[model samples]
Target: MKKISSKMIFGILTGIILGITMAAYAVSVPSEQVLYSNSATSETTVNGALTELLNLSQECKSRCPEGYTCTEKKLCKRASTSTLHTETCMTGSACHVQNNYKTYGHGDTITYGNISTTAGTLKAGDAFDCDVNGNGHYESDSERFYYVSTMNNGHMRADSNIAVLAYAKTSNTYRLSSGHISYNNYGNTSYGPQYALNELYNTTQWKNAPEIRSGHITDSSGNILKLNFSYSGYASRLLTYQEVSAGCSIPAQVVSYNSVGVMDSGGPLSYSCNFLLEDSNYSNSSNSVYYIWLESGVDGRNDSAFDIDTYSSNVSYDSVTSMNYARPAIEVPLSDIDY
Candidate 1:
């Protein structure tokens, strides 16, 4: 009805068109509201929405116990109390476990064949008896002698038939018999042998006594004969009549002998005999000797011998002044001997 203007009309139409375009753009834009059924667009919008929500949640106060704290990953955990416990914590992959023990008591005596100390420690003046093994009791006196039986346990007799007369002095405190005889006589003597207070002045009989010694004998034909001899010594003291009944025998020869020296005590003393024939008639016999002495400082008699064969049939011998002083004697074959 009034005067119309083209400029005003054009401005109005432009404003209306712009408003419509803004409304259309808002409606078409993607939103997190879409279900995953939308595939590509749904994953992108949902991730963006989750990130914004987490950031907002962190800004709020945590609702956990006083001793607990919220982790960066939005989880609550209690604080650890002890560092030691944590350090030693075991896992399924790591673990371990241990087991044997030993005991020393009575009936566990330290026995050296014929001689045995109490289950405890040994001291001076302890009285002991030397039985079948030739181990004698300890005595303060230097000049003491004992007759000890040296035999195998399996062959031991109640009568003490087999034994060696061993002597000892302060200067010679060890056994002087062969190791073979000493070892075999362990635990086989009855009541044990007592020590004689008097010192044995001479061992002439012991040294020259019947023994199987080994040596080479040359015949008149210049042929050497490897021989072993069992010869009796004349210097030996006569066995008491009672001793003879108990298996002791009289010496075959009589000769003056010297006292046993410290050097001659422990060793391999062997004597062997070979008869020399003059035109089929036996004329003379020779005995060879073999001996080895151990240089141990202890005073005692430790000796041994082998049978006809040097390599086998061995026996041990032990000589101690007293049962308390004796130790286990050893007799090993030359081929099987080891320290």
Candidate 2:
């Protein structure tokens, strides 16, 4: 309000001019205006961004749990939907189950001791009881006996020759022939395809020749001679003999006995019989006597024919005698006969 000095008045006028220049400069600065406008634009862009808006929309729709977003790159994961992950119940593999059951095929051949059999498809732990066949075994008395007789015919002395008496006995699967016992003072003996008693008896020691007459023998009184013999046509001669004792006593005489003279001799002279006798006794007692009657002669000759014609036809003979002192008789165990 008081009149100022000249310097003070000029200073006041300079201050007013400087203040107006500062305000105009601030308003006219383009950098500050551009900075404000850019800040606002940046805030608006963030609020309206496409990705952010999508995330918010998804969150509102509950597409994913809290703090999660439905993103194209990070989709929801789930359990596998493929069938390859499942297990199969049945498989065709060799060791696999079929219809919930196990099956097997033919396995390798297995042998146990002296027995063997065909092994077919079976379970791993399956077991079987085996019995072997085709091994030589006793067929029957008739078959064995017939076989021996057929072999011995015309080769062994009928009257002096010991008969092959065969008894039925259970043998292994390999013994299928009749066993014999000799009337000689020899111990028990055996003969077969391997042990031929007929052959042994025909040797020089026996001095007896086989009569090829297959007819029954009779005493001078026309009584049929008692001779128990097997029907086996495969008989073999005694290969060896072991003297046991004199003739078997009455209790033991079923096999050991003397043979009467042959039908050709007509003298009825008893011959000393020493050989294995057939096991075919009339009864269980050893004293049982067996009679012999010519059933068929070799070469198809009648029993009455005695000449060479008859002898030629006689395949085997049945000779019986009385009071002949043949030493101990031999016996062939049934276990040794080979079919």
lDDT of 2 by residue, 312-331 (tens): 11112232111111111112
Candidate 1: 10-residue stretch with minimal lDDT = 272-281
The global C-alpha lDDT for each of the candidates, from Candidate 1 onward, is 0.22, 0.22
How much lDDT does candidate 1 score?
Answer: 0.22
Candidate 2 error regions (>4 Å): 1-133, 136-276, 280-289, 292-301, 304-339
User: Which candidate leads in TM-score?
Assistant: 1
Using Cα atoms with residue i matched to residue i, what is each candidate's TM-score against the true structure? Answer: 0.16, 0.15
Instruction: Give the range where candidate 2 is weakest over 10 consecutive residues by summed lDDT.
Output: 267-276
